[model samples]
Target: MAKEIPQILKGFRDYLPQEQLARKKIMQKISEVFERFGFAPMDTPALEYYELLGGKYGEEGEQLMYKFEDQGGRKVAMRYDLTVPMARFVASYPELPKPFKRYQMAPVWRADKPQKGRYREFMQCDVDIIGSDSIIADAEVIATFDAAFKSLEIGEVKVKFNDRKLVDQVLTKLNIVKKDIGNFMRTLDKLDKIGEEKVVESLVEQGFDRNILKKYSQLMEKSSKGYVNQMTQLLSGLGVEQMEFDKYLMRGLVYYTGIVFEFVLVAKPEFGSVCGGGRYDDLLEKTTGVKMPAVGGSIGLDRLFAAIQEMDVVAPQTAAEVIVFNLDENLTADYLNMTTNLRNAGIDAEVVYEPSKLDKQFKYAQAKNMQVAVIFGPDEASARKVTLKNLREKEQRTVDLANLVAEVKSMLW
Candidate 1:
């Protein structure tokens, strides 16, 4: 028999302890912002029936979806994004309250070719407002995006936005036929990536006249000024100052019916948009046979974390705050009791399973980036006291067993 080598599929990855901890912290911060804005947490499965997911995404998205028949011979597909599944969720539960506000943090799969920040499987932090068609709803979603980045302290971020209605007006002005509008918009979205010359070439290849595309290129600069001014005034009260209009921000989703916005790190524009989403009023109506309006946005968590690493954001190496050292095997039960007491007082405490050399235990605590260590040697036990060692400061002090929790708390905080 041959031994197998460990492997993982391409475009997927396993996050080590430090990276996962940072990612969780990022999610928690974003979730907190969402809840503060009155959005509640909810979730959907990673897989949905093919019929439910297929054709919802535009052509490009359809190609990138992980779809196949299941063992039961039922067509199933991994969710490519959270927005579509949210539409399905709303349609399934018709009795859900009006103006639903939700936040979901979960993994979504895409069969896309992996790149520096792009991955086949990644977590998305999403928030949506359903049932209201007010412009305030759109502004609220954008404001939430701004708040999330502010909470993360990821430096300056600009939430660029443009309305599909405005894009439609531009397309109509360019004499682009209704049938070609969607394809034209999708191609227009590539302008920032491929540049205007190539976008013109692409649209020309798609049978648009050269002169019209050239005119379209020239009109782009002036097209967004008015809308940008309008949105800035609307978003004034929300404390969202880092926003502007991007004529090229035609998010490639087909369901978007109104405004679309993207969050980009101002200091690192080349890092691309770490989050993007828009309004989709008709998404649920087609399934539930009722008028439903929704607007949502998602943070590309993996890509955001990658940017965070590159930007040198401080992150903890371990979640454990303190480790209880195992000194004497006979006193293991006492160490366990102290660990429990720390935990009961809302501290993150860990105890070594077996008695180990003091040097080895000290090294373990240091390697885990623990702030403090609790040592209960026979001498301290006999004295009814415990030694609290500040790992980083290389300081130690003796405290009564009754004061263990307070002493550790002071050391950590």
Candidate 2:
């Protein structure tokens, strides 16, 4: 038999419990916020027909799609993002209510070279509202994310946004032809990465006059004030405090037709935008042949997780809150009963199946970050009591088995 390979492909990962729990915690917080705004849960296939996803993401995005022919000789590709597949979904099911609001948390793939906080495969926590073009819809999306981050205790973030319409206006005023607006926006999106001088140089190389490039840059610097004031008032009314209007936030997606926003971690700006999305009014019409306005945002979950880790936000090492040590093989039944009672009382409890040494069991509890450890020796079992130890406080107390649930609950709380 051939030796099996023991490695995962580049840009992919296997999430063990510790990492997965943190991600899930973040996702749960995000989902709660999404649902609070009346967004319903949704799911879509990981793979879609190539034609369905093709041409939606612009030239660079197309190149980064993980595309291949399937076993049936059909061209298929892993979804690049949740939004495109969402467009297909709305088109396929016209029966879906107008102003459809949905939240989808799933993995997306990209073939782009992986870098810090960037990956070939990662989870996107997305929430979208379709069939609504109102600015209120945009504000609601922003507010939901603001609430999610606050809930996650990820510290402060600024929701920086810009209007694509304003960018278009600047382009028109600068005599940038319609044929080149897409390329111009794509170039402008790199302003933060390459700096203003390099952006101007790149545009000049693309045949834009030096004077026009300078004029465009000047206009970009000034055009965002009025829009910023308007959005600031709107978002403030919704309790979203930190927002800024950045004229250069031209999100790279060609589909965006209106306001686009990105969440920037104030504490760690080098991690880049942890979340971003924009309005894509023409995309649904383009994909489904039915014109409907839509706007959305996605939290780059892996990146956000990395940021949390970098910030030293402590996450629980294990889901189990209470570990019941099997101190004696003969006392297995007692241990199981105690664990069962704790679980029945809505506490997450685990019991050692095999008898283990006292020190080893305590070490396991500590390693797992278990809050409480219950030991049921023959003495305690005979007395119908258990020794409950608080791993965090390093204290122990004897509680009657009848009151063990309440005692553990109190300690955990």
Candidate 3:
């Protein structure tokens, strides 16, 4: 028999306990903010019929999908984003109320080359409000994202937003033909990545008139500022702050029909957008033949988590708060009982299953980052008392068994 390989595929990863716990903490903070804004929790399958998801994302986006044929010989693709699946969901269930709002935290796959923060499989935390075309919905989505970042305590972030309609207007004013609009907008989206000179060069190479390109550039600068001012005032009125109007932000997704936005770290602009989304008013109608206006955004959990770690944000090292050490095999019952009492009191406690040397147990507790270690030796067992040691502060106290829970709680906090 051949020895099996013990390696994970490239662009995929396994989260250790420490990383997983930190990820959970971030997700919890996001989920709390979503619920506070009245978005209900929901989920959709990771796989969908290929035709259902095809062409929803633009040409480049479709190329990045993890597509294949199932064993049953049916074409399928892993979902690229939650929004499109959500549109299909709304269409499938007509009885859902208008302006339906939902929050989903799930993994999506993209077959793109892996980089620092880019992964083939990553988690997206999404919140969407459907069946409403009002800018108020857009404001609420932005505001919800603001609340989430504030809660997470990530440093200052700037929300750069623009309306696709404004881009359309600019193209029309430039006499850009309708057939070239998609290519033009896509090129415009790359302005930040490639400099202005390169963008112009690319557009000119695509046969756009240099004179018209220059005109379009100048007009966009002026119009973008005007639109930014209007949006800033509107968002301020809705209690959202720090919005910058970006004329060049053409979110690469083809479905976005209006107002698109992205969140970038103020301290690390090169890290790219940590969160982004926009209005897709025609998506539901296009996919399910039902008209439903929608606007939403997604926080790339993997990227955001990486950013938080890079910023030196402190995270808890262990899930267990206290570990009850086993001093002797004979004291196993006592150790189990004490751990149970602590757990029943709403504390996360663990007991050593196999009696081990005191040094080994202490080392284990330290490795797990446990806050407190409860010593249950024969002396303490006979006295019906426990000696609690603060692993971090290196302090120890002997307490009556009756006060064990209280003593641990005081030390943990």
Per-candidate Cα lDDT values, in order, are 0.87, 0.89, 0.89
Q: After superposing candidate 2 on the true structure, give the runs of residues whose Cα lies further than 4 Å from its correct spot.
A: 1-5, 221-225
In model 3, residue pairs whose N, Cα or C atoms come closer than 3 Å (at least 3 residues apart or on different chains), thus clashing, are: none
- After superposition, which runs of candidate 1 have C-alpha atoms over 4 Å from their true positions? 217-226
Q: Which residue pairs does candidate 1 place in steric collision?
A: none
**TM-scores, in order shown?**
0.95, 0.96, 0.96
- After superposition, which runs of candidate 3 have C-alpha atoms over 4 Å from their true positions? 1-4, 211-213, 221-227
Could you tell me which 10 consecutive residues in candidate 3 have the lowest summed lDDT?
Answer: 222-231
Scored by lDDT, model 3 comes in at 0.89
Query: Model 3, 1-413: lDDT tens per residue?
Result: 99998999999988889899889988998999999999999899999999999999989888999899999999999999999999889888889888999999999999989988889999999999999998888988998988899898878988999899878888898888999999988888898889888998998899988676578768878777866676687788866777787778888899999999999988777779999999999999999999889999999999888777788874666889999998888988878888999999999998888988999999999998899999989899889998999999999999998899999999987
Model 3's TM-score against the true structure: 0.96
Clashes of each: 0, 0, 0
Q: After the best TM-score superposition of candidate 3, give how far the Cα of residue 217 lies from its true spot, in angstroms.
A: 3.5
What is the C-alpha lDDT profile of model 1 across 1-413, one tens digit per residue?
Answer: 99998899999999988888888888888999999999998899998898888888889889999999999999999988998888878877878897999999999999998987889999999999999998899999999889999999979999889899877777788878889988888888888899988988898899988776667656766786776777798787898988878777889889898999998988778879899999999988764566799999999999888888888874676888999999888997898899899999999989999987999998888888898989888899889998898988999999999999988989888
